[model samples]
Target: MADGEEVTLDGRPLHLLRVADLKAALESRGLAKSGQKSALVKRLRGALMLENLQKHSTPHATFQPNSQIGEEMSQNSFIKQYLEKQQELLQQRLEREAREAAELEGAFGAKSGDFGNLSHLEGIWVKFRRIWVI
Candidate 1:
């Protein structure tokens, strides 16, 4: 609903609706890519579909290996385990991204790549504006 435009669905924003609308939208896209299984798509599609529920502009949502997410964070055993694993993965990724960002910063100080330091995301628009030209 952001970065991309949103359209009115029956006089209301499409995002105001339920998971059903999301399912329909995704299904309407057709053709599944090769090498990926349906189960993975089903869960991912479900989470993205659920994102329509968020009122906030920024995407605070992330995927758990087992599907159900964020506000719908599941209490199911498998989902719980998956969520814990995902937290660990997120921590590791944050650490890695921070390290990579530091390395990139040292190399060019944001004069080169988009992958540079981002301790303050405030300058993202400035960087992105520059980045988007290429």
Candidate 2:
């Protein structure tokens, strides 16, 4: 934000960039690539600062709401209503998903039932199935 101030592009300090990366950036900007890492960082920073300045030169549009107290109160009420509606919808969706999951588990016996518990006397059910085809 100031002269000679280092900015990070990807969490790593700009001055700590690899020599090859610094050279690549310099080359891209059509700057001299024969300099040391510090010189490269300086050049890149200068180029980036100029670019930032150019970006800020453009005029930006800003929101201008009604200054009247009644209109401001209406805008606030509208925002509150929208947010409350979204929250209620989210709560309803969560409740419905939970209920559907519970119904599925009950219908499928996923949580409470286990086939291993309904055992016969030491493989009696297997024998019964073989003999009693009906």
Candidate 3:
């Protein structure tokens, strides 16, 4: 965001792209303990995420309408992109579950009505995700 400030490409912000650049940056500053260094990296990553999130707005589905007070913006390219990315993520999750279920078929041989405890039926899914989410 500022001169000499680092930006993240992956989950980590402090990853070294070029060894020379990393060496230069480190040599430019004093050192800390390895644990402290990792914590600093995490904090920097969190700050960058918040900064990036502020730039891109997403419309959230709400129980009580807030459009009256207008804190949430109307759906835009950002919201559309978020929905598309979410759909892709969900599709990948479904495919993973299908694969896992198929693998379990030989062992469990379960039918539609097989599971008694809803937890067993739900398998890998969390509680709120299974509740009226359909």
Candidate 4:
């Protein structure tokens, strides 16, 4: 299969891998397998892509110069496509991470005057504070 190409099971995509098989693969890779099919597919794809990246290094030296314009063009196009896919994947990952970070910040961000145990009394406390206590 070409680089970045997804693996298929039973003519369907990798997501079609049965739950048992997917769990086995995840456990073998030391990953948590407690999610749904979509999550499993995502984890497996990321693991597979990471493995593929580790296996393949720079492809520049692998190309054999061909005198035919068509052959050279095809190889160049393939390389360009592969690089573009990798770039797209990286961009997507960056966006996902940024979104998660923003969510985490939103979850943990509390204003300075926010109360923890007496949250329900926040506005009441502000309204009933001593009038002369500056």
The candidate that achieves the highest TM-score relative to the unseen native structure? 2
Task: Score every model by TM-score.
Answer: 0.28, 0.38, 0.30, 0.37
Listing every candidate in turn, what is its Cα RMSD in Å to the true structure after a full C-alpha superposition? 20.1, 20.3, 15.7, 23.5
Give the higher-lDDT candidate: 3 or 4.
Answer: 4
Better of 1 and 4 by lDDT: 4
Q: Which 10-residue window of candidate 2 scores lowest in summed lDDT? A: 113-122
Tell me the tens digit of each residue's lDDT in model 1 across 1-134. Answer: 45475444445554455556544555565523332344434543444545555654575468456443433544466766775675556557667877777787788777435754454442653454343222
Ranked by lDDT, the better of candidates 1 and 3 is 1
Consecutive 10-residue window with the lowest summed lDDT within model 3? 66-75
Arranged by TM-score, best first: 2, 4, 3, 1
Looking at candidate 4, what is the lDDT of residue 49?
69
Clashes of each: 0, 0, 0, 0
Give candidate 2's TM-score.
Answer: 0.38
Tens-digit lDDT track of model 2 for 25-93: 778889887778888888887887787788888655574455465455446867657655655565566
Q: Which stretches of candidate 4 lie over 4 Å from their true place?
A: 1-4, 8-12, 58-134
lDDT string, candidate 4, 7-81, tens digits: 654456777789888888889999999889889988887887677777886667656576465455446867657
- CA lDDT, every prediction? 0.52, 0.65, 0.51, 0.65
